[model samples]
Target: MLVLAIFVGAGAFIWPQLHGYAVTGAAYGARVACSCRFVGGRALGDCRKDFEPGMDLITLTEDTAARSVTARFPLIARQTATYRDGWGCVLETWRN
Candidate 1:
């Protein structure tokens, strides 16, 4: 029981760091989070946030399917209308 407790505690302390390492970008900066510059891709699905009067924000879907990266690291972006604005994204399919 003591060994199990120690192992669990160690994992808890190091899990975040491990997760950080799992998330990596390729030669181009295109990770789950849109922190770097990347070209626009296709729209995979419908927009979740539709723009309306007085609505300043809108959500659009794009294809971030990369064939060289991990499927788990697929990227998504949320952009605003009228201007080429972008927000962070989460990877879905690197090769999907």
Candidate 2:
């Protein structure tokens, strides 16, 4: 019971920061992977090589038909970016 309370307390404090970082990481991963896959003409699986070392928690998925990539950080955050002819890769607008 005491351990559970402590865990809850810690989680309440840490969750917001963790969620914020996850959001940023997901957005960055989506944009980078989109560009790598669509603009660089690389396979989606191969785009992980382009991410920074600490981004392992982010997972990327490609929409070949839409020319976009979506990235997720476990249950915390998700974001998408699409490739355009003139704009390169553009992140989708965030919604509340």
RMSD of 2: 1.2
lDDT of 1 at 87: 37
lDDT of 2 by residue, 1-96 (tens): 999999999999999899889999999999999999999999999999999999989998888899999999998899999998899999999642
Q: Clashing residue pairs in candidate 2, if any?
A: none
**Per-candidate TM-score against the hidden true structure:** 0.31, 0.93
**lDDT (C-alpha) at residue 75 in model 2:** 81
Candidate 1 structure quality by residue, lDDT tens digits, 1-96: 999999999999997775443333221223321322232332222221221242222222333343212212224222211112353344444331
Q: Model 1 residue 66 lDDT?
A: 30
Q: Indicate the worst ten consecutive residues by lDDT in candidate 1.
A: 76-85
C-alpha RMSD of candidate 1: 13.6
Error of 1 at 47 (Å): 33
